[model samples]
Target: YDPKRTRFRNQHRGRMKGKSYRGNRICFGRYALQVLEPAWITARQIE
Candidate 1:
């Protein structure tokens, strides 16, 4: 994932800049899955 893009989203859409969203692990995990699954799958597929 692009650090710049993540930073932008965290700052703008995520509303999580410089603040502790640590209690929201489920939300963060879901967001991470949504962001990373495509690349992760493409890299691991056996076909």
Candidate 2:
């Protein structure tokens, strides 16, 4: 049982699910950036 590989597979599956759910309006990269940017800015401000 390779946990790392399993985790990667699960994440990949989730990304695919998001793509289908959004009807391809958001690619994975853009979706991730959209999600991360706000949190990233907030973390930077706190630092």
Clashes of each: 0, 0
- Steric clash pairs (candidate 2): none
Cα lDDT for residue 36, model 2?
22
lDDT of each: 0.39, 0.38
What lDDT score goes with residue 17 in model 1?
34
Model 1 misplaced regions, further than 4 Å:
1-17, 27-47
The worst-scoring run of ten residues by lDDT in candidate 1 lies at 32-41
Write down the RMSD of candidate 2 (Cα, Å): 12.1
lDDT of 1 by residue, 2-45 (tens): 56455345333343234333563565334532232223235456
lDDT of 2 by residue, 1-40 (tens): 6565553453332222222335435545544323322222
Question: Poorest 10 consecutive residues of model 2 by lDDT?
Answer: 12-21
